[model samples]
Target chain A: MRLPNKTCAMGATIARINDGDTVMVGGFGVPGTPMTLIHALVAHGAKNLTIIKNDANEPGMGIDHLLRAGLVKRLITTHLGLNAHAIGLMNAGKIEVEFNAQGILAERIRAGGAGIGAILSDVGIDTELAQGKQIVEVEGKPHLVETALRADVALIHADRADPFGNLGYVATARNFNPVMAMAAKCVIVEAEAVVPLGALPADAVQTPGVFVDHVVALETLTEEYAVVER
Target chain B: MIARAALEIESGMTVNLGIGLPTKVIDHLPSHLEVCLHTENGMSGIGPTLPSDRADRNLIDAGGAYVSTVPGSAFFDSVTSFAMVRSGRLDLTMLGAFEVGANGDLANWKIPGKFSPGVGGGIELAQKARRVVVLTTHTDRAGKPKLKTECSLPLTARGCVARIFTDMAVIDVGPEGFELVETAQGVSSADVAAATGAPLRIPNTALPSF
Candidate 1:
């Protein structure tokens, strides 16, 4: 339960940037997210990063910044159509990614958190998503079964957090945070405000601080989904 | 029968009219009834019959196909719109029927011959809804009846249809059975049965002409 209040664009800020790392995202199309940590990652100058999330970030918010920054090289997500940057990079062969359906991505993240080996959902069966994935015959039929996932890092956003780092999701942004908390090796929280230990309610806590390794604070929340025209 | 069905359709009915013949129901509006159209992906208050001129690239149906946005329309997400459909909050949904047996099995989502984005949202919409109204031509092109003894195609939903409105006839699906409610202009009950691919029971005094 430590805070790493790193400034953007500082070379020392990027020492935490790791390669082949997976960041569990917390945002429903830019509504709720830790824009500071995300930009720090960009300033951190990481490359060949693998992102686990629902969709490719868009022009003004979410992971679209990363895609625009040309820092990320791969993504495991549901849709690439939304983020034109990611799609363009992929089309240009600058990045590689595995696209999944919305439900499949959610369940895979859940399976990883649940500590189960894998799930046998046939949502993407008999199609491209099944190409390299396992196909277990359940009563003599091919099922495009998905495997469990474990991330190297969980980068999440929290509504309120104590000094100890236990947190709650503000609203609909809570969709993936709880499940993602258990799916990663290291959890980093980027909170708008950081408070004293035990400041957050036990019932309100969605992702406990026991999982958080780092916390970055924002002076005040600002719209971070803006495209980096500069 | 048309008057009776009109009772179920109140003003401000937000409906998702299914593809094919059911798409024609927009024309059936009484001119006074306010029906707001919702296309999946996120559009409420869809415009009339989008063909070329009205095709708005920014506007799309819930299925992620481009559609025309009407004068007063709002676009959200395809997921949110479908949530409305699956949540059983839609007032009424008019669907196109391929086959509806005495058991009320549906087969509009798939043809089973080729790869279509089969059963995208049909299963959820047809399976659970407050009211289900189907629209189709009563007979097939070969003089075979589209209404069959059993669904030859894969079923989308089972035992959920309440009423059926076809070009040649109107029928009600009740606990009692397939009751003929109306015969379209210049169509007979006997001709309606003759066109059907299945054996149908016609209720007496219900030579409904809507």
Candidate 2:
């Protein structure tokens, strides 16, 4: 069968994902995770990957599948307090973890997406999160310089997408997808529904088509709750 | 403590309630006033918790609890959400504490031998919010005082907390040190002073009720 525009088979897209690549996965809890794409990546067996996300989801869900698959080498996130497996991995020295204050993490990604080098802040100056960071003085006040974070690929889920790749997300599920879409070298979206162009109104489009590289429409969109691995 | 903390919140203000004790403050907010709630997970105008049968699984507060939305609720991405926090748009922030030092230093994220995965948005919310209030008990589970001259646990942010509401008293972090604002009913200034790990100062004026 001939290929259709930007839409590609999951296998072909997952094949392009390489080891040691930094990936930004979108979701807050189980809501907006790109589960089908993640499953495909697991099936493809790519290892030594680094994932930057909001949290290491609860055991047997979301990023935990990748962690269980022994694919993720490093995790840069705000918290993993609820996920025992991620904590166990960190405690066992099986994985490297870098914790950013949640807001700083989001801002750094945004800075990377906007091409800015770094931003200064007083958020973690006295905490472990700022231990070795460069402290710059501005006008007399000291601030920690937080570097921008960009990824090699961003695997995001969208509620709806157009053929041209414009996207829309639902509710709180919209958390990290739009920013991750901007900060990655390749943006692959798992769209529940791929609508015709212009069907997603310009005013409603959260991530413009220009930032998207590929769209893989799910064969059968899994219910949001079913994405919970447990 | 939660009720006392809720009283500090004014009408029509945007507030960020940290995990643990601070989250309970929402239950005590006056019904006549409209208060907007901001969660780091990316939404504002939060309503009360929802029953499981009525909950939309996809919609939840940052704490992972199902929550309803107010009339003006708006959703955005992580970037915009954090921007609102970092830019000082939040009127108040109430957080739980492990230990709060005399100079207003906060240490809430971790303690030795415990698996605290990471510090979430507490850092930014502590530093940027117009006011930072803390909710905690007078002592640890072991009955050891938690309000200290210097934090014994790992610090989350420095000199960020402005006021604290404990089960025993309402205290303010002033330039001189911890000032006893008021005590719980039937609790005395001396009782609060003894409970605090750090020195407690009582102003000359009559202390007001929380």
Which residue segments of model 2 deviate by more than 4 Å? A1-4, A221-230, B203-210
Worst 10 residues of 2 chain B by lDDT: B50-59
| Residue A147, model 2: Cα distance from true site in angstroms | 2.0
- What clash pairs does model 2 have? none
State the fnat of model 1. 0.00
Q: Candidate 1 — what's its lDDT?
A: 0.63
The sequence of per-residue lDDT tens digits that candidate 2 reaches over residues A59-167 is: 8777898999999999999999879999999988999999999988988998898899999887778788988899999999999999999999999899899877789
lDDT of 1 by residue, A1-230 (tens): 65443223223433665876767776544434556667778777677788876566566566777877777777776555446667667667787777655545556777787789788755535234456887788888666678887888777777666656677654234545666766887777767667766567678676767766666565666645322222
lDDT, residue A85, model 1: 64
TM-score of each: 0.55, 0.94
Docking class of 1: incorrect
Cα shift from native, residue A123, model 1 (Å): 2.1
Clashing pairs in 1: A60-A225, A61-A225, A163-A196, B39-B62, B40-B61, B40-B62, B41-B62, B41-B78, B182-B208
